[model samples]
Target: MSSERGETVAPDWPHPSLGNDLTPRVAAALAAAIDVPDFGTDVDATLAWAVATGADVATAPLAEAWQLLASTAFVDVGAARIIEPHLDALRILAEAQRDGVAADLSSLGADESSMWGVFAAEGSGMRLTARTSPGGWTISGTKPWCSLATSLTHALVTAWIDDDTRGLFAISLRGPDVVCHEGPWHARGLSQVVSAPIDLDGTRAVPVGGPGWYLSRRGFAEGGVSVAAAWWGAACALLVPLRHAARTERADQIALLHLGEVDAAMWSARASLMAAAEEFSHDGGDTLVASRVRTIVAHAAEQALRSSDHALGPAPLVGDAAHARRVADLGLYLRQHHGERDTARIGRDLVRGPASW
Candidate 1:
């Protein structure tokens, strides 16, 4: 819970959208309803509240509310809470599939849910496995980065077991053998994400499907779309404030024009991502389309962030405004889990055939 330098930064004003009074009240209500443990901070509590609330609300309303509350404080709270529930659901679905039980996953609102799974690296860092046992199997390895590790309840960890290499396991968060260490994540932006190293110390875990669970055609395709959605959400966080700053602040015509272009590109990127997500849900997941969506969204996000910085000038760097923190957070969050490299791979896959490594 302390910064790397042990420097105590001053407490920032509560996010404007959350309001001084209302945000706390909502957070309190959310804490009371959810079963979050005592280990997390206030931001963690708040994120749980926002996601739980947003998940049940209508899509437009949820997005509107998220826009209002999209601050470092709110995002920290929301991302922690949002990731776990979806991860738990995914575990159940994957387990059901493994056990030969058919499931109707459409009702879970696939488009809105976040993917909270973990994939391991072989030998040095990138190997997959799944060892079997009579009672239950055990998974041991390290995942490069788990974005919501601090708050995630379960993770789909990939590993190599026995002769099979590409294996998957649904590991519970509350298990004894699992050790989640907060890794060194010192970046200029997205300071709150806590995308750290997680050590699974021979943890007892339930197997999900079989070998090729993660890299298989279906899983890879769906995963691409899910990652695209997350990137799109981050893009919107930047766009909303850029639009406000452009309309209200005294900026040049060129700045306004650049803002317009960024907005258009972001919207187009979102549409493409959503279309791919819908396709995955409808056509049982398509890797080609998913890779294309991921590539487009990554480019769009980079463009949007750069344009926002250009339009807002030094405003984002000076004040402790929610917009400023969001920009910083997005910059860091986008880099998590081989973000740029993954984006490049997606592009390469689009040009070539199916994706590999």
Candidate 2:
């Protein structure tokens, strides 16, 4: 990675933190663990290391947490994919606790070994609803995009509280009433992280927040930005082979040109992430800023992918497992940005009112 002064830095270089004391230690731990031979393949080991880091987004500086996430993604996109959701779930619960929402880890089936996920995607003609019963709250219906639902111990699901209102609930996926359906998930990227629909038959749930609270919270935007950080990290990882190709075997002007383009895109994206982290640390979450960061990073990631393909060709994709996985995982992950639809929405928002630059 290139600094603002045009000097090179290691991929695991620690970004400046907002007075967070744990930042350096966290960076060192991640840098040390990421080089392990088995860390990428063992999700449990990665998760355990992540949990041990004790980096809480709610308590620590948001930049610190985002940097941690980005560093994890830089080494292993699959590991980052697994770690991100679990951390997000913890943040959601923390927010719930801070808001005086009635929730307890034990009631949510969270334990020392519990793996958490968030399931909020709604499908057409399929509705998941939470209804009040004498026995407490129960959720029934099919929830789409429940990643790792079969293997996860618990999840935070968003379901319709009423006709037009949605609320967040924590439920145990291990219950007899909860069923993880087979098939439907066939993606090459992040192949280990299976995302499929889950069927629930009156599964017991504990509400984390009130109706509309899940989407309305500031943390929601912050969470979106966190995904962008992961995207940025994967983009950075793609440059590793590019840099190697540039160093080991010099090439013509065309390869150098593509390398420069990739570098410019990734450098700008990294700068954007750091700037966004500073803003989030102070001003909290602004939907517009978060959207802009995600959109900008998404564009940069796409550019990096394109330029890398043009420069290195098919050797890295076929010869290297980590490089190939990062390429595919990043391509798939960037789709969460919603492309032109989100871009148009941002443009319309800018046109409608006052903007923050």
TM per candidate comes to 0.68, 0.89
Q: Model 2 lDDT vs. the true structure?
A: 0.77
Residues forming the 10-long window of minimal summed lDDT in candidate 2? 1-10
Q: List the residue pairs that clash in candidate 2.
A: none
Model 2 over residues 1-357: C-alpha lDDT tens digits?
112111222444443222344466556766666454456456666666656553444356677777777766776677678778888888887777777885876875577567788898898977898999788999999988887776678889999989989999999998889999755778898777788899999999988888899998867888888898888877876666666667655677777787788878878887888888888767777888888989999999999899888888898688766667678888998888999998888888899888988
Off by over 4 Å in 2: 1-22, 28-37, 54-58
Give per-residue CA lDDT, model 1, range 43-129, as digits (tens).
Answer: 465445444554442222222332222332233323532443343344345535655743343332233433344544343653434
Stretches of candidate 1 off by over 4 Å are: 1-43, 46-95, 98-123, 126-129, 148-150, 162-164, 217-219, 336-357
lDDT of each: 0.52, 0.77
* Clashes per candidate (backbone, < 3 Å): 16, 0
